[model samples]
Target chain A: MNLYLGVDIGSVSSNFILLDQNGRLYRKLYLRTLGNPVKALKDGYASISDGLDKQHGKIRAVGSTGSGRHLAAVLLGADVVKNEITAHAVAASHLFPGAKTIIEIGGQDSKIIILRNNIVHDFAMNTVCAAGTGSFLDQQSARLNIPIQEFGDYAVKSGHPVRIAGRCGVFAESDMIHKQQMGFPVEDIIMGLCEALVRNYLNNVGKGKKIEEPVVFQGGVAANRGLAKAFEKILGLKINVPAHYEVMGAIGAAILAREQMELSHSPTRFRGDNFVLEGNFTSNSHECSGCPNLCEVVCIKRDNEVLAYWGDRCKKWESSIKQPRDRLKVV
Target chain B: MSRVGIPRSLFYYYYYPLWKSFFADLGAEILTSAPSNRHTVERGIELAVDETCFPIKVYLGHVAELCREELDYIFVPRLVSVEARSYICPKFMGLPDMVRALIKETPPLIDITVDLSCDEKCFQKDIIRVGRLFTRQARKIQLAYQHGCEELRLCRSLASQGFTMEEAIKMWEGEPMEAESETDLNIGVLGHGYSLYDERISMNLVKRLRAMNCKVLLPEHLGSEVVEAEAATVPKRVFWTLGRKMLGSALHMSQREDVDGIIYLACFGCGPDSLIGEIIERKVRDNKPFILLTVDEHSGEAGIITRLEAFCDMLRRRRNYRSESKLSPYGASLHSFENTV
Candidate 1:
């Protein structure tokens, strides 16, 4: 029972999925990444349980994606560690064949993917805009005395959505409070906020792009029906949210692992699950004075040949073959 | 008591008047190498690492020549930006740092700050800041800057009035050779400053393509005024400096039915060019069977010309059927690279 594993670790949460032959999933787990991704991997490994432990059920190849994919790959001995864009796009295509566009608003960033012939023709990412991301919505929800879980329901109930400044996060807050003082309904205000966020994304980041139809919206924001409605109104097109919308990145990564494993015809890079069962996997760092960006490169190694290296923008201290590229065996 | 060194390839070809005037105003002599020859290019590659793009390599080679002349300050403009929302490539933006790191030369570089990215007033303030680093006298620096600006204005205006560079040169230095054999195969070239000038890496395509009887029209040939005028058609109001220049060049070139084909010189690892170039290619590539040539330090001249020759051959046969090149039936003064018209 050869199986492939994929892990996506983010600032907010960590996702783990395992898939067997014919791309049929076996196990999947979503755990808050917290600060220490090492612990999250251990927690996920524990959740996957004893099924993968048997000699017959071998872990063939493992791939990692997300902000923490590099370190996770090193710990998990992942065969591939890809950037979020490729991982998300690959998974979206699999989930919805011939997916034209993927609008991903994660905890920290938002991305627009335009795909053609099951291939990504172009993509744009906006890490600069904090106002359009899920984290901003979370903060706004907390301030307005609205539970994040009920945000979608409240937004849909609005009669008249109030307009809020979407250019800056700070400005949006002041404008939001002003509307509330003016006797605007909470539901209406919430819906307005969602519309404003969508407007900001389209105006700033999505500018100059030809956003075609068959759109798939994923990441944490997919939970918000109000935002979905806002997008539909603005684009004049229906949007698709994959079944595993929140964890599509992880699911895509798992699919990549399965694809690579079948092609490699070798043993898995999944450094035994005991990697977590063992004591603290130690790491060290040093200042690489390559450029002005004095990247505090962290090198994680249990024993000798450095298992994983990260924290440098230029990949200064990255494991020789580079993060994701190292996953491939050229031989 | 000190001299200035300038690279002959890039800004030199166009900004020589302004740069030369600025140094002269500062009461300093100038030293620049002869037009790029093959050995100059080879030496440029030796001074620069392989990863740098074309213009950088030519710049390095120009620096190598300047090193022998024994100059004190090389006028390396931290050409930050020319306009808001537009910027030179990150490579150009980070050039001074890259040069200091790469070149072992002992001369301290005079960073002529041209940061137009910031508002004009602030950009001027930074220029003055760099000027203060040179001379203590305020009046002389201002005078030099004014004189330098006057020369640039004159260059731009002359280019605008459709004065043949030869005719305009007669106004400055007397008439030169009546451009021998006016019947050269006309072709339009679109690319960054570095790709066109850096002969070694961009494989010095202009001269080679010219030698093959093809007339090379550079981005500089497309006057800024004409580009700005036609650029109004773009709905995005995309005002990025290089982006505007690129689109303007493509649009202006597109209207010329006489041009057999267009060559878009692209650089490896350049982000803005990749995005904007793709946009232009999607729109204008099929309009005339254009070829996109990419260059890095490792690019071979042989491979480049082979592609160009293939493109020209395809053009010569008229076998390539693209949308008809846009030419007003009246032939209303088709755009010229050297002239705004």
Candidate 2:
């Protein structure tokens, strides 16, 4: 009953998942990062490990993904640290075996992955712009005096969605305001905003990509029924949202960890539940004046013991530490 | 003895060997601005006009650094065209005037206009005119120019042996560079020399790839004739010199059996890159994995790392899966989940 753990520490949310030996989801937990990934990761891990008996089995390996993947790997002793794109693609293809396309819109980024025969053929991520992501939806929901959880319900009730500029976030906000001033129905405006975001996602992230069915939509943003419906309307295809869409990245990581452990036959890198629960972690950064680059090198520590160092261009600070496990590898 | 300062930006990556040798042969002490760093980028951003590309802005920063030195002259060449019917970017053509307008209290500039578009006679005359500043010997100037051409050829030849233009230049300057070890992946990286070679501008892209156990294939690795032939397949000739090279190089790389994937580094505001990037994206064939990474002042290293990692993973997975089924190329035998678990 050995279990593999996967953790996805993203910009907005941190998700954890456990996969049994047979590659079935055993347990999952999702928590808001709240601008502090260290706390979110610890809390999520604690919650997932709680109330589990010996019958559930011990963790074998750990895999991490998303924007804070490197940070999570350092803290969690992850066996594999993967990017969000690969993680999402893996999870999508696993859940829906024939999933040819994946539309992943998370807190600050959106991506479209085109898969051929369950293999990722092509992919594109939003470049330098967070025009249509969960963060924007959160901000708009707050401005509209509607809770983000109920935003989809409001959108679905709309008769006609008003047109709003979606090329840029700033422009879209202004257009939303103008539409609001023009006395459009609140539901219609909300639905229109959803439509505009879909348009932006297609034009930017999905540009030149042949998005065939069956398209699987995941990430934290997939929870929004309005956005899901909007994708269906625009792409004119049935979009499948996995039961655990919010934690697909974590699931993918878990699957990868399971695979890695089987291939390498290596012992679990998981530091154990006690290590995560008891370790006192803190990080500090300082500008290195060694040269004109002035790279801001960051040091991560657990109590008094230094764990890792990064951010120097010349690897002066990074290589100074003798810990082979703390070395930053891009993969 | 006359001192001439050369800003280490833009055309410096391409023609630095030629200029250095030319000046040294004429008995002029050559001083190049230090490699680009945070201070250089910041100063350039402040001094340069808002609309110019990042390399041009960096060039201005290098010029500003040159101004700090008590040199007798700074060499800010007005490069219009190097080959017939092919021109450098308009920014290079107006670089001398831009530097003059932006920076005050600068030393005398030997702003030689190098235009070999229609003919090489005027360029030869311009080269001699600049040489006169160091020595009055007409034969000496001609010989210096010949030595410069010879040095340039050596640099290019060194580059074709699998080193970046910057590394080749360093080797040309007698710097000992270790040969890169063989790796599992062969990645074709294409971009303008100034933007791509400058570790700061490209955020150490080539070094990062090498560290990730990849052999980087640069445009310089391909011969000019091969690149030109590939580029000529286009419906219309690319007029921009660097742009043409990029197109030709990308096309050539796409067809190479050894090359796995191609990555194009493009600046956000570059006019030539805006068009050239799209053309390369469309022109690249054989379903070769191509990713156009756009960088600017606001580019974060995290974004770049994520993209690079994903791209590398994609290539590795594709290669592994392809090798597993050599007989049936597109066989459905590999159930990704089952295979992994």
TM-score of each: 0.57, 0.96
lDDT of 2 by residue, A1-331 (tens): 7887899999999999988877778889989999999999899988887776678678888899999997888888888788888888888877788889999999998999988877777889998789889999999989989999999999989999999889999999999999999999999998898999999999989888888999999999998899999999988999998899999999888877776766667676678877778999999999999988888889999889887898999988888877545222546
Q: What are the per-residue Cα lDDT tens digits for candidate 1 across A172-267? A: 899989999999999999999889999999876676567888999998788899999999988998999876788878876776676565555666
Query: For residues B1-341, could you state the per-residue lDDT of candidate 1 as single tens digits?
Result: 66888777666544666777777777788887755655566777787777676567767777777777777888777776777766766667777776788778647887666767657887667657756755788777878888988887676555434332322323433344334245445787877654565444456676667656677665566767888876667777665577778778887887777776777877776677777787777767546656667676553233454355435544543422233443211111112111100
Q: What is the DockQ of candidate 2?
A: 0.46
Please list the residue runs of candidate 1 whose C-alpha ends up more than 4 Å from where it truly belongs after superposition.
A49-51, A55-57, A289-295, A303-305, A310-326, A329-331, B1-245, B248-341
In candidate 2 chain A, what residue range of length 10 has the lowest lDDT sum? A322-331
Q: What is the C-alpha lDDT of each candidate?
A: 0.69, 0.88
Ten contiguous residues minimizing lDDT sum, candidate 1 chain B: B332-341
Q: Given the true complex, what DockQ would model 1 score?
A: 0.01
TM-score, structure 2 vs. true? 0.96
